[model samples]
Target: MSSPETFDIVVAQLGDNWTLTPVVFENEDYQLPDTPAPFVSVEIYGDFFDQASIGAGERDDNLWREGGEIFLHVMTPNGTGSRQARQYAKQLVNLFRGQDIDGVRFLDASIGAGDPGRSFSNYYAMTATIGFERDE
Candidate 1:
């Protein structure tokens, strides 16, 4: 069998706020440096998806199994980089939340390029995936 994927799982119960478990996922790309902008993308990603907590299940080969994906792009003034591309990707996931018929998880976040000189233009993109358990 393939190796299992370990992720930083966050769970939101029936009424309480979401909780971030201490268990660290095998993937550490999601952890970002403490930036001045504070990488508000995290907040945006979560709020955009209305996700209260992280997923609570294993991932399949599909894009998402239970959790969703959020993309964040930091663009330059010239608008020439992977920043916008990445943001667009996250937007794609946000556009289609709670609509999956298969009930799979899709927490795949990717980043693009950044403008080396621009202020915030130092573009960067981020995606957050949320996976949930399959119901009987």
Candidate 2:
């Protein structure tokens, strides 16, 4: 499967939290809604697959590992200084860091402070990046 598909699976694993309501796992080619506030978006920005070595002069065809980073954008209403967004981003980092989804392992995760300029002028936004890998 593609990286975006993997992101869907990750969001499914996160389920939902009431503290950050209206969470959205955007599908491929999806556009952000104009009215939603205090929402979360999970998106995969990159993916990579590499062959695994089993022994000398031997590579495992079935051991190709899929890995990538998923970007999480948390947005809140304007003038909040992204306070809520930062909180939600922290929660996301705590939930996914060093965790595993099925057999997919999350190697690392981190979140940033809110940046109003990075998103809509009416919203405060914070971002998180999660790196994951799995044998496929």
Candidate 3:
């Protein structure tokens, strides 16, 4: 027997409409820690919106079952960016069309704030749910 590959599952579950892009922002706001790390941005193209809407709409009381949206995942210390973030974001687009994640709130008060906190490493070994805003 063979072990299931999550990456392949991600591709199969998410389909072709979803894309993962790697970005390195030098600016203070977008900069990661000193480590040479990679963060992923998962985007659902325009065409997939229609498909996501139908499936998510018919589901039970699920946040992703109401409206369409684009989610952003950030890497942190504990829950750093894993393959799941990329794969799941795409799966969300493929499985939950027209679903809304307007109220998805992620708290990070422990990360500190202001300049001191800014100097701290943002790119830890964990992936975090950064945002889930509506596409509109």
Candidate 4:
């Protein structure tokens, strides 16, 4: 598999930490459960940057700085308080706060305070965006 595909799988595995909600990964033909339940949506974004050169004659083309964020959207019932969702976010934080998975060194995680606007009448949602980087 290519690097992006490998990264995608690595990020998807982090969603496994959320056992309370079903996970929906990107690139899959999927829809949230119809019964108004909690669920997780996962997407991966990455890029490679050129490394600064310090030598007069060296192969700099091979040096690359790669990184990305694992964007996870956790959805829960709107009427219910966000305690469960926040707890889930905490679980995610614990999973990736400062760890490396498949060469992706996770730097930190950001949990959305709360987003009622992202919710419909029946479900409220929050986001946990985990940032990671690697140099190769």
Clashes of each: 16, 0, 14, 0
Better of 1 and 3 by TM-score: 1
lDDT of each: 0.32, 0.69, 0.31, 0.70
In model 1, which runs have C-alpha deviations exceeding 4 angstroms? 1-83, 105-125
lDDT score, candidate 2: 0.69
Q: Write the per-residue lDDT of candidate 4 for residues 1-136, one digit (tens) a residue.
A: 1256546656566655556777777777766566788877776777555574545465764556666777777788878788887788778767877876767688878888344426766788788888777766
The best-first sequence of candidates by TM-score reads: 4, 2, 1, 3
Q: Over the stretch 1-136, how does candidate 3's per-residue lDDT look in tens digits?
A: 1112222322343344434434322222454447544454333211221223334544542233112222334333334544544454344344433332233221222111121211124443222222222221
Clashing pairs in 2: none
Compared with the true structure, model 1 gives a TM-score of: 0.24
TM-score for all models, in order of appearance: 0.24, 0.75, 0.21, 0.77
Residue by residue across 1-136, what tens digits does model 1's lDDT show? 1112211222121013212111122232554434322232322222112323445464332232222233332322234554554454454345334433244334333333232323443433344333333222
lDDT of 4 at 15: 52
Superposed model 2: Cα runs more than 4 Å off: 16-19, 28-36, 54-60, 113-117
